[model samples]
Target: MSGLDQRRVLVTGASGTFGRQLCAAFTAAGARVVGVDRQPGSIDGVPVLGCDLTDPATVPPVVAAAVDRLGGLDLLVNNAGVGGPAPAELPPDEVVRQQLEVNLLAAWRTTAAALPALEAARGRVVFVASRMALLPLPLAAAYGVSKRALVAYADALRHEVGTHVGVSVVYPSMVASPIHDSTADAGLSLEGVSRPEPVQGVVAAILRAATARRAPRDVATTRRGRLELAFARHAPTLADRLVRRTVATRIAAGDLDAAPLAAGMLRRHRDATG
Candidate 1:
């Protein structure tokens, strides 16, 4: 984990915005990289295997293939995730299930499959979580819940495997990607609520975590993200108040007016505060 040179790395979601950049960066640093994605292709000269990570039956064999291709696994980056908006007031639905399956369970299964190779090499695992895991927003319950659960999984994995395999979680603030397409289509666009950061910074943060002398417990991609994480952790009540205010302002401005999925919460917010 001290460096990337000659390291055999397997990254999930290799065809994604962050995944492509990550492969390029790692390749430039002299690491042997392979990627797993739903779309099998090459990114930055890195080969990506096509696999549906959410399918429990396929993750093990896909991971084994990557390990065998790389000769051995030195690092596993769980970068694959999906996002959508689901209101907290609503009952769990397909959106909720998809988020949990992809964002949380997919990483868990991938990591579990990669553990033997990682432990044998005394390697590392880095999970690409999100700022939502720490500081959540309204109308995006699925994404928040899944990411938070991913972090919890990472924490537990660290406890169980800390002796040999290093575990780390990197939280990036909003990065503009197709991951937000579903949310935008749902009329819950985070246009003003969350700032979209560059994908490079997030990739860099993940690289740092992968190469750090000792795997850091949690890493935030930007200065603002670190502050947000600290505020959410140290003063949760205040953090809640701030989030409430943002949601209220958005509601007052009719931001959620077009989102039918947000109707119940919008009606309740208007009734209670009007």
Candidate 2:
């Protein structure tokens, strides 16, 4: 029998690409999966509850209600997050706060709400943090900050609860999905960026992390991503410079429109390296 057989999973963002795939994959593994999203959603057969993660008041009630329906929770997948390739210019406080609330605080709130059931069930927590958590890209400042905070929160949670609850954070880099479509529609060219890995690989990694004997502390999907992570962690100066160069080049090519701040960031990285 599969380890995941009969596991009860609560996955947020069930309407998105990864979310839909997660529900299908878990269901295929014989898991009883419940999803929370923000739309009139349908996904083959998964039961989805609509709840805006950004709403503080909605999450606990929504999650409590979902867990009640499931008879308990065995896994809580904190997959609801939003923030895209940001311009180098500082965004409005509203924009930044919105991203922070959704990408970081929502996950924290969801995990807090799920902890009681998870502890009772010895369940797992899977955080879908982006590779931006480590390799902070130039344009996506808000995204990078939120993802990094998510990873940090996961770490702290693991220390607080890992003996009884499995904690894992998946850091997949570039994946071809709806995100790219949105970026493209905004007229941003991701051309010449490393080819995004298949969506299948991304989901597979999440499943593996969720079901591992001992949950991995961190998981990265791409070799390039892992290397970038290493450099960012061990050689921040160099990582900063390389990331800046990439951004500066994109700006020069007109693929990005962040010349002013990108140039300053690049200069700072250079000075820090020297």
Candidate 3:
């Protein structure tokens, strides 16, 4: 029998592109799935409770409801997040804070709320971080930082609870989904984004990460993501050169902000290298 057969899974961001796909995939594997999202939506008759992840009081009850529905929890997928892409020089603090709260703190609260059930079932926990976490993209510092912090939290949590619960984080490159629509509409340039990974491919990787006997330290969904991660680790100067080049191109195209704004970022990279 497949490992997922009869598993009880709780998926956050159930209304999102990746979340919806995960809910469907897990349900098809015979897992009893319960989902949560701020938006009122459902998938294949699966129960998707609506609650703001940023609100601490709202979390416990929703997690309780999910656990009760599934008879217990076997998996928790923290996929809810927002992307605020803009000139890193002047990201809106409100937007940055919202990203941190939702993408980082919310994952903590939801996992903490569900840990007891997860431990009892010896289930797994998954965090849907981003490719930006590995190699910070230009004009998207807030998204990168939040995801980076989330991955760090995942590492710590995995070590703390690895004896009972599996822990993994998936870093996906661009996907053909509305998740990037808001960023594009906000006038953030997407020049650095590689060809999008199929939604199905990403969902499959997430399942593997979540159900593995030993969850990996990290997971990436695309070739570009893998290469960037390698470059960031073994070739920092090369990575910085490519990123700076992209930033310069964006500045020349007027897709980014003023000259000084871009200059500051370049200076920081050079300073860090030297």
Candidate 4:
């Protein structure tokens, strides 16, 4: 676990921007990388498996294939996620349920399937969560709820694996990625976006956290990001109020759109405070 060299790594949603980058970065780090997506193809010579993560039955076999191909998994990156406009007027319960199914349940299924291998290798699991998980925003009710669940899931998983497997959750701000294209169709915008943290940074952090004997529960790009973690710990109510104010300001400015604006505002607050 000291190095990615020869370590087996699996990345879900490998066809997407972040997932593709993650696969490339891990390969560059000398890990034997396996990419899984709903698409059939390969990236940078890495094999890509076509699997539907939403189907509970598909996850275990996918993990088994990855283990078979790589011998065993040292790292599992739960990077697959979905978000789109769900009619602002929709019932909160319905929207939240769908969001949880895709963003939270899918990750849970994937992690559960990979846990034994991870425990066997005493490896690591990385969750690519959003800033919304920490701070709630206005229009993104479902997305926010799902991310919050993911944060809870990661925390619980960390404790469950205590001193056995490493668990790291990353909360990234707006990044220029195709996710914007999909969400934009649903009234989202990626304007004024923070530069996507080089995929290498995330891969490196995962490698470090997993291989290292002890890994931190979370990793963020900036001090402000770190500060959000602190605020979440010390003053959750104050944090919620601060987030609400920022979302209000964005709405007033008309710079925020319906889809991603809430998440965008939370990212801005994180950046400003960090």
Top-TM-score structure, candidate number: 1
- C-alpha lDDT (0 to 100) for residue 24 of candidate 1: 94
Tens digits of per-residue lDDT for model 3 on 114-179? 999999988889899987787787667888999999999998998899899888889887776776
In candidate 1, where is summed lDDT lowest over 10 consecutive residues?
A: 265-274
**Predicted structure 3, TM vs. truth:** 0.89
Candidate 2 lDDT score at position 122:
88
Stretches off by above 4 angstroms in model 1 are none
Error of 3 at 69 (Å): 1.0
Compose the digit string of candidate 1's lDDT tens values, residues 143-189. Answer: 99999999999999999999999999999988899999999998999
Residue 162 displacement in candidate 3 (angstroms): 1.3
Using all chains and alpha carbons, the TM-scores for the candidates as numbered come to: 0.98, 0.88, 0.89, 0.83
- What is the RMSD of candidate 4? 5.6
Ranking by lDDT: 1, 3, 2, 4
List runs of model 4 lying over 4 Å from the truth: 86-89, 92-98, 186-208, 255-274
**Best of the two (3, 4) by TM-score:** 3
Q: What is the lDDT of residue 49 in candidate 4?
A: 90
The digit string of per-residue lDDT tens for model 2 on 1-274 reads 1278988999998988799999999999999999999874568888898898888899999899889989999999888877655655665466568778988999999999999999999889999998878877655677789999999999999999999998999887776666556446545545655457777777888898888888888887767767877887899999878766776576556664444434555565557757
